[model samples]
Target: MSDSEKQCCAPKRSRAGRPPDPAKDQAIMKAARDLFLERGFSGTTIEEIAANASVSKVTVYKRFCDKETLFEKCVRKEIGRMAEAFDVGDGSSEGLEQRLNAFGLKLTKFLTRPNHVALDRVMGQEFAQVPSLGKRMFEAGPGQSRARLAAVLQEACDDGILTCDDPLRAAEDLLVLWRGFIEVELKFAVRPAIDEESVRERVEHGTRTFLRAYQR
Candidate 1:
């Protein structure tokens, strides 16, 4: 079995005296995430999720009102776990270019993970059925990531490391630059899977280009 499969099956410890078991919640989310990625939203069922989680259908319902809600929670949980990609250091030490490179590498690598790519495909398919899912996922993930990167850029501007009238716009541009055609190619299987060296080269190129345009 794969590492992720093993992780899903691993026992989770929980605290006592809670009405809702955190362990059960983790199990449910793990099962739901795997099923959604493998089968997309429409194909996966609550019965399957409950079975995989070793919990009853009612237990799943008690934790999450519906399948849509459970899906959103799973996506949000993944996004929150990857949020540290935007850390970019304390801003008092790392140079703007260096920080951007670091952030770009982490962000792009996270975006291109097999599970994340699968999740994106699932979201694309489900958006037609659950219109609000796209909006909520964007706000919870990419929108929040952009805001964090914008704060980093704003800090650089304040420190005279860069010149930017709008940090948010700059952040978006940098993200687009970093993603480039790689994301499209990955999504469509137009090329072989990206390796660490290729990712680093792309990130470094983007960071340098961004600094050239924005550096004071």
Candidate 2:
């Protein structure tokens, strides 16, 4: 055989596997969130999530062991946003009351979204059926948020703006006093609805009430 013919007959090397894209994980989680909100937990499927995210089933499965894990990831992401808002800001120039008032309104605005309402309803309905879901959601979202709020409260105590021996207890009480059942009422579609105006009004009232209890 000619040398050129022998060279041409050499076996071609297989292509190396493509590196995993980090953005695909975000896409999968975003798609999963939309589907979960629209279809509820039982109605959604991994195949739909894969198609919606423009990723393969193997890709999805590689990141998440099961549909339940994927669902938790989506919920946790939103919950993180919620907790971020509740953690409040570190503004030395602003008065403690002002910071708290802003924080309350910020948290209200974040939680009162249509998608948030949908998530609450879906999670509430399915929490019983999926035992670990509630715990995961709590730990990832509310629990962390409580700790963050506690930190802010402790800062206020150090500043002498508030007198709180146990910041955790104070934070929990503040949350309950500010939001509490209002979230449940808003999520469940209580009469007259929980509009922006009403929510803000409630937040204002709660802030005032909380300041009275905690402020120096």
Candidate 3:
């Protein structure tokens, strides 16, 4: 066989000697994310992450190619957790209002968390410094959530349940309703972190108001 063919046909390497430790991975990710949030991306260092994670620099590098890659992974991990809230059920059995209320509540709680608020600040700073990183993070996180929400709105419109002419715009409107100006308040510490009752009340009001505007 030619060198290329032989290389392609070679036995795949087995990763059986020792499995990667999920605990260690989680520790590293948590450490890196917290550090990034506390001290903007430019201020954070791989050595600091390793020290905080209680792992060696070699261990950090083994899992992530470099600090940039590690930062990206950390961002994705945090956003991925938040993205779960966007999976409002298929618009079949559940009423759209119920789904929207549920989604709003979950999203509000996630976004208002201290860590998440800090993340938004760090993300903004990073975006100013490295637009590409910001773009990628937005695409992976909020952009995707908006698209998912738009999909739900479009489905409702197709079913004649809502009268949305523009699903994306409607989605944006609904999200704004749910979020309001809470993030700004939290970021500036002008208002305390929202409690669960406040979140529920906000979400319920937002869902009702959204339906009033969009319901067919």
Candidate 4:
């Protein structure tokens, strides 16, 4: 595929030319993301990102302050992808369980991916050394996405499909449950089998529990 339409899931490449296609920005971020996940926070560098992305150091520095900034951008980009994966339907007429089941399934599928789990582990390890990095990651990733989910939960409550005293907390709880379910067995260099049927079963169970707690 063309650079502009390159798959977001692909590994880094080396092709960014002058007159710089906006696609180069994606290339840079993609490179940074792959490196960060593979090497962790301190292990990555701007020179590496530039070389991997086939862009100039000046190009990388122009967009990010340092390695930290690039790492943050990568986290944001990945989380943005996760958020985009969930439909979280806009005020659908469907029952709360139906909508949540779909959301849970998509979320589980994304989180259970081996690469995604590895990325999360890297972020977790980095966060221990750099607290602010974790904060930035939360704000950009789960923090922003949770707000969107909270809004949807509030809408559901208002529509009388659910009974949540604090929609934000409820949304957060759902996210926690979803993450816990999918990440239960994920560990570095240890990827256990997670079939489609198992994922759907887990999503169904989680969605059912969430609904039971909130259903009106």
Q: How many clashes show up per model?
A: 0, 0, 0, 0
lDDT of 2 at 27: 94
Error of 1 at 62 (Å): 1.6
Candidate 1 per-residue lDDT over residues 79-194, each given as its tens digit: 66655555545554345566677778878887776766766765777776767877876776788778878888898888887889999999998999899998788778786578
lDDT by residue (tens digit), candidate 3, 1-216: 233322212123347855667787789899998888777677888789989999977677767756777777776675556556546566653577777777678778878988778767766876888888778777766886787778878988899889987999999999999999999999998986889999999888988888888887
Candidates ranked by TM-score, best first?
Answer: 1, 4, 3, 2
Residue 174 miss distance in model 2 (angstroms): 1.9
> Which model scores highest in TM-score?
1
Reference-based lDDT, residue 60, model 2: 72
**Tens digit per residue, CA lDDT, model 2, 79-130:** 5565455344454424566666666766776676676677677677677876
Clashes of 4: 0
Runs of candidate 4 with Cα error greater than 4 angstroms are 1-20, 85-99, 188-191
The C-alpha RMSD in Å for every predicted model, in order, reads 6.9, 9.9, 6.3, 7.5
Off by over 4 Å in 2: 1-19, 83-95
Cand. 4 Cα-lDDT: 0.71
Superposed by TM-score, candidate 2 places the C-alpha of residue 187 at a distance from the truth, in angstroms, of 4.9
lDDT of candidate 4 over 84-137, digit per residue (tens): 534655554455566666766766786777766766776677788889878987
